[model samples]
Target: MFFCLLSFYGGNGYAENDLQRDNPLEQYRQLFAEQQKEFEKQRRIIEEQGKEIEILKARINSLAAQSPSSQPPATEANNDQTVIAATSPKKKIEIPSKPVGQAPPQASEKPRPPEIPRLSETVGGVLTRKGNLVIEPALEYAYTDNNRVFLDAFTFLPAIAVGLIDLREIKRHSFIGSLAARYGITDRLEFEFRAPYVYRSDSQRSRAVSIGVGEDEIFNASGNDIGDLEFATRYQLNSGSGGWPIFVGNMVATVPTGTSPFEVDFVQSTPGAVFPTELPTGSGYFSFQPSITALYPSDPGVFFGNLSYSYNAETNENVGKVDPGDAVGLSFGMGFALNARSSFSLGYSHKHVFESEINGQTVNGSELDIGQLLIGYSFRFTPKTNINLSLGIGTTEDAQDIKLNLRLPMTFDFLSQAY
Candidate 1:
C-alpha cells in the first residue's frame, strides 16, 4: 500500500515538475493549456445552442415556413419577441412638447430698434413745444366807428416765424416766428426781440365849420404798414431771490414801422389852396425804453406773476424839441394756467406823454395815449399739431381799435424725417 501511494505521488510530481524544469518551453506549455480549456468551454456552449435551434427549425419547417397565420401560439411567440426587442439598450427616449400657451425665445439673429421720445401739443395752438422753431400766421379783420381809436376799420394779416439758440440754458431754446425770440448773449442773461407787422386803412366824414374847415371838406387817410421792433433783456439777479422774488432790470426799444399817411385841407379853404408838410413813415426814430421787473415763482408752481414799470424817451427830431419830452408807462400782469390745455392772463398798462415841439413851435403835444387788454387761448388738434387764437383791444387817446389773431404750429423731428 505504501509503495503504491509513493508511486502515485512521485508520478504526479514528475509530470508537473518536469515541464517546469525544462525552462526553455515552460511559458509555451502554460499558454497552450489555457487556450485548450477556452476551446472546450466554447464547444460545450455551441452544442447546447445547436440542440435548441434544431428543435425550433424543425418546428418551423414542419409548419412549412409559412406566413404568420391566425394561430394563437405563433402570435404569442411574435409578441414576446417584439417586447424583448423594444427593451433593448439602443432605443431612443421621446421628448415632451411645451405647454400650449408657451412660446419659445426669439432667435439670436434678429435686430432691435432704439427708443426715442417725441414732443406734444396743446389746443388753439396757443402753446406747442418740440424743436427750436415755430411759425405763426394769422388773418384778422376788425371794425370800429369811434373817434377814440386809430381806425374805424382795420385789418392785420400777419405771419411770424422764429428760431432760438441757447434760450433758457437747459439748452431749451425759445422761438416764435416774427413774434418772440429769447436767446443767450451770455451765461447769466438773455435777450428777446420781436417785430409785428400792422396794416390799417379807414375813411371818415366830419361835420364842417367846427374848428376852421368848411362843411364840404373832410379828413380822409387810408394806408397800412408794419408795427414796431421790440428788444428786451433779462438778467439773473442773486440766484433767483430765494423764493421772495428775483428782480431783473430791462431795456426795450420800439421802432414805429406803421404810421398813417394822410393829407389835410381846411373846409373853407379855396379850391386851389395847399399846405406844405413832411410826414413820418416806415419806422420812427429809436426810443430807449427802460424798466424794472420782478418774477415770483410758487412752490409746486401753480401760481406765478410778473410786475414791471417802464419809461420811453422820445428821440424824434421833429417832436422832441417842441411838444413832447418823454413818456412814462406802467405794466402789471398776472398769469395762471387753467389746466394743461388752458391759461388766463390779466394786465394793465398806462402811459403819459410829455408836451414837446412840432414845426419849430413849442406846441403843447396833442394828447395821445394807449390802453390794452390781452386775451389768449389755444386748442390742440393732436399731439403734434395745434391752433391758437388771441385778441387784443386797444384804446388810444385819439381812437379805439380792435385786433384779432390766430396761429397753427406743427412739430417734426429732424432725425425721424420722412421723404
Candidate 2:
C-alpha cells in the first residue's frame, strides 16, 4: 500500500511541472502581440506628425507669396527646415537633381559693393535698374580771376623793359542750371540726356600802355543764354566677381548750342586793350569723349579711378577754320560710406590739352594744363530720391578757381506692372 501511494505522488508532481512549462509559452505569445500593436501605434503617430508638417509648410509658403518682403532669407529658411526634420523620424538621404561634377549656377543677386559719392557728371554713383528712369535737376556756380601783363618792347635787363607795359585784371563769375534724364535699357546699359542754361558776368580793369596813366579803366560785361546739350551712354563691362574690379565704359557727346566766343562783340577799352562786350556761353565746336572707370571695393572704403580722352570737331569761325584742342584726363579717388544713406568722396582730377589750330596752323603757346581737387557728398532722402553736392578747387592756373555743384535725382520704375 505504501509503495503505490509514493508512485501516485511522483506522477502528480511531474504533471504540475509540465503545466508550468505550457503556461510560460502561452504568456510569451500574448506578450509578442502586445509589442506589435504598440509598434503600429507609434508608426501612425509619426505619419500624422509628418502630414501636419506638410500643412504647416504650405501655409508658410502661402503667406510668403502674399508678402514677398516678409519672407525670411534663404539661408534662414533652410536652417529652419533642417531643424524640423532632425526632430522627426530619420529619412533616407536624397540625391540632388543636378548632374554630378557640374558647377552650381552663379547667383545674380550676389552681395554688391557699397555705393560711393559721385565725383564726375559722366560717372554716376550707382546705375539705374532696368526699365527705370531717373531725372536729375542740378545747379552749378563757378568763379575765377586772372591777371596778365604785356610788355611790347624787348627787355633790356631782368625786370626792365624799354617799351610800353600793359597791366590787366579780369574777374569772372558763371552760373548754370541743368536738367538731366537717364533711362536704363538693361541692367548693365543706360542712356542719358542733359540740357543746361548758363549765365555769365565779367569785370576787367586795365591801365593804358601808351600813356603814363596811373589810373585804371574798368569794363563790365554780362550774358545769359542756353548752353550746350549733352548726351551720354554707359555700359558695365564686368560683373565684379572673384575680387576683380568693376569696369565701366562711357561715351559722351556735346552739341554746340550756346553763343560762341567768336560770335561775341568786342570793344577797345584803352590803348592796346580790348575786351569782349559780352562773355561767351559755350564752346564753338562739338565734342566727343570716351572714358573708362574702374572701382575696387576694399573693406571700409572703395578705390576708384578714371581715364578719358576728348576730341573737338573743327568748325568754321568768323576769323578762320578754328580747331579746338584735344584733351586727355586722369582722375583717382577714395570713397567712404558714412552711413546707409550718406557717403563722402575725396579725389584729384587732371587734364592736359594739346595745342589748338587756326586755319590749319597750330597756335603757339596754346597748350594748357588743368588740375583740381574734388570733394563730394551724397545723401539719400528716400528710396527713390537723393541729393549730391560736390566742390572743386583749382590747383592750376588754367582751371577754374572754385566750382560748386548740387544735384537732386529722383527715380521712377516703368516695369512695375510686369511684376
Candidate 3:
C-alpha cells in the first residue's frame, strides 16, 4: 500500500513540472499575427478613399476649364479640397432689359441735388434750369371793405365834437389776369417779364349829416383796363452746403400803364359824400423793389423767407404832385412735401407803408400797415408742367379781406439735346 501511494504522489509532481516548463512566447506571436492582418485591412481602405478624392478633383478641374473665360492654372496646394471650395463659381446676376425710372449710367455721373417745389414768384424757391424757359399764366381775385367817419365841424372840446358826423362804408372787388415769361441765363441767374390786365368794381354806402334821407345812400363804380407791366431779375448767391441756407437776390421794376386815380372824375352823391364815376385799374406810379430771399432744407421740410423794400416814384397829377409812400415788406414760411407730386405751405406776409406826400406836404392818416396769412398748395401734372394755388387772409384793415391766385407754369427745354 505504501509503494502504491508514493507512486501516485510522484506522478502528480511530474505533471506539475511539465506544466511549468511550457513557453509564453508562442501565445504572444499568435496575437501579433492577428493584429498585423487588421493593419493591412485599414491601409487598403485609406488607399481607396485617396483614389476617390483624386477622381472628384479631376471632375472639378474639367468643369472649370469648360467655362466661357479661362482662369490661370492653380498651384499644387490650390488643388486641395479646402482651396477648391474657396474658388467655387459664384451665382450669375441677371439684369433687366429695360430699366424703369432710372437715369442712364452716363447721365448719372454728376447727380443733381434734390429739388424742392416752388412756392411763389416773390419767394423764388428754385431757379429755372439752365437753357430752359418757363411760361406762366395767372389769375388773381381780391376783395376789400373800408369804413370811414368824417366830421364837418371843428371839435370844441377833447372827446367831444360839435359838428355833423358822417359815416361811410365801401366795398371793392378786383380781378387780374397776367402772363409771365422767365428765361434762365445761367444755372444761377434768371430774367422774367410780366404783363397784366386788371378789372375793378366798387360799391359805396353813405349817411349824410344834413340830408333828410334815413336810409344809407348807395353808389357803384367799375372800370377795366390794362395794368402795369413788370420786369424782374434773380441771381443765386451761394450753394447750400454744410448746414447753410441758400440765398438769392432779386430786383423788380414796374411801369405804370393804366388809368390813374386822379384821372377819374368824382361826383357828389349826397351832401358831404362823393363817389368816383369809374375806378382806377392800377397805382399809376412807377416802382422799383429790391429783395433778398433765403431757403433752408431740413429732413422732410423746407423753410423760406424774404425781405424787400419798394420805392415808388413821385408823379404829377391834376390835384398836385404826389409821392406814394415807400414800403418795407417781409415774409416767412415753411413748406412740407406731402408726396412726390404734391406739397403745402404756410406763411405770413407784412408791409409797412410810410406817409405819403402831396405837394411837399405830408398827408394826414396816409400811413398803412398790411398783414396777411398765406396758404399755398402745388401739384405737378408732368415733368414740365405744374399748378400752384395760393390763398391770403387779411389780418389788418388796410389789407384785402381775401385774395386768391392760381397759376399754371409750363417749361420747355430747347437745349436738352445739346446737353
Candidate 4:
C-alpha cells in the first residue's frame, strides 16, 4: 500500500511541472502581442504629428505669399527652390488625386501688391563689404598760377627812400594717376594701399630792375616721377539707423618715396636767374593723418562730413633743417541718387596750415589757407564696376585753380567660401 501511494504522488508532481512549462510559453506570446500594440500606437501618433507639421508649413507659406516683403520675388523664390532641390537629396511629397474632373483651388481673395526693387546703397568713398576687394584706378589734373613780389633795399638820404621792385609769376600744371587697392578685413575694418605717378610742368617769368630785360625772362621746367606711397586703414566705429549718423575712423601714413624739391639741383642759366632742375613730386618728410568721417542716410540721398588733422615729421637734408607745416582739414558733402545706376555729389573742403619751422626757427609767411568746392558723379556699368568723375575748384589764393579727376572702380572676391 505504501509503494502505490508513492507512485501516485510522483505522477501528480510531474503533471504540475508540465502545466508550469506551458504557462511560460503562453506568457511570452502575450508579452509579444502587448509590444506590437504599443509600437502601432506610437506609429499612429507620429503620422498624426507629421500631418500637423505639413499643415503648419502650408499655412506659413500661404501667409508669406500674401505679404510682398516677407517673401522673395517669384523668380527669385523659384531659383532658390531650384538650387535647394539640386543641392539636397530629399523625398518628394505626392498629392492625392481626385476621382475624376476635380476643380482647381480658388484664387486668393486679396491680391498682393507688386514689390519695388530696393536701391543699391553703394556710393563713392564708401567702405566695401567684408572679405571683398576693390581696385580703383584714377587720374587727376590740376593747374595753378601764383604771383610774387620782392623788394630790394637802397641807401636812403635824409627823408628820401629808394627801393627796387621785383615781380615774378609762376604757373604750374600737374597730372597724377593712381592705382588704389582696398580690402575689407572685417565688417567694420578696412585697409588700403595707393601708388601714384606724377607729371608736372612749371613756368616762371620774373622781372628785376637791376637786370635789363625785355618782356621778362621766361623759364620752363618739367618733371615726371612716382609720388608718395600711402597706406591707410579705416574702422567703422558705429553703424547708425533712423536719425543717427554712421561714424568711421581713419588713419593714413605717407612715405617719402618721391623726389623732393630740396634734393633737386639749382641751375643758374644767366645772371640773376635761378631755377630748379626738376619739380618735386611729394613732401620730403613722412606724414600721418587721422580723421573721423560721418554719414547720414536719408532715403535717396546721404549727407557726409569729415574732420582731420595731419602731422609732418621734420627732416634734416642737404638744404637745411626743415619741418613741413601741420594741417587741419574739414569737409562736408551730400550725395544724391539720380536713378538705379547713377549718383551725384556736391561738397566743400577747407584746410588750414600752421607756420613751418626751418633750422629751429619759425619761417615767416609760412601759414596757408586753402579751400575747394567739389562736384562728383558716378555711374555703374555692372554690379561690380563703376565709373566716377569729379571736379574741384579752388576758392582760396593758395589752392589750385581747378582740378579734374576720373576714376574706375572694380570689385572682386576671393576665398568666398571661407567667409
Q: All candidates' TM-scores?
A: 0.46, 0.73, 0.73, 0.69
lDDT of 1 by residue, 9-97 (tens): 99999988876877758788889999999999999988976775565455444444333352236465565445434544375322112
TM-score of 4: 0.69
The alpha-carbon deviation from the true structure for residue 360 of candidate 1, after best TM-score superposition, in angstroms, is 7.6
- Please name the candidate that would achieve the greatest lDDT relative to the true structure: 2
> Candidate 3, after superposition: displacement of residue 260 in Å?
1.3
Q: In order, what lDDT does every prediction score?
A: 0.44, 0.84, 0.81, 0.76
Write the number of the candidate with greater TM-score, choosing between 3 and 4.
3
All-Cα superposition RMSD per candidate: 24.6, 13.1, 17.2, 16.4
Error of 2 at 102 (Å): 31
Tell me how far the alpha carbon of residue 221 in candidate 4 is from the true structure, in angstroms, after superposition.
0.4
Error of 1 at 332 (Å): 2.2
Q: Which residue pairs in candidate 2 collide?
A: none
lDDT winner, 2 or 3: 2
Which 10-residue span in candidate 3 carries the lowest summed lDDT? 91-100
Model 1: CA > 4 A from native = 1-144, 148-181, 184-188, 210-219, 236-241, 256-283, 298-325, 359-362, 378-388, 394-401, 405-419
Flag clash pairs in model 4.
none
Compared with the true structure, what per-residue lDDT tens digits does model 4 show for residues 198-317?
999999988875555556868888888999999988877775744577877889999989998787887875454578888899888999999887777776888877888999999998
Worst 10 residues of 2 by lDDT: 92-101
Which residue runs does candidate 3 get wrong by more than 4 Å?
Answer: 1-120, 162-164, 210-212, 417-419
- Ordered by TM-score, highest first, the candidates read 2, 3, 4, 1
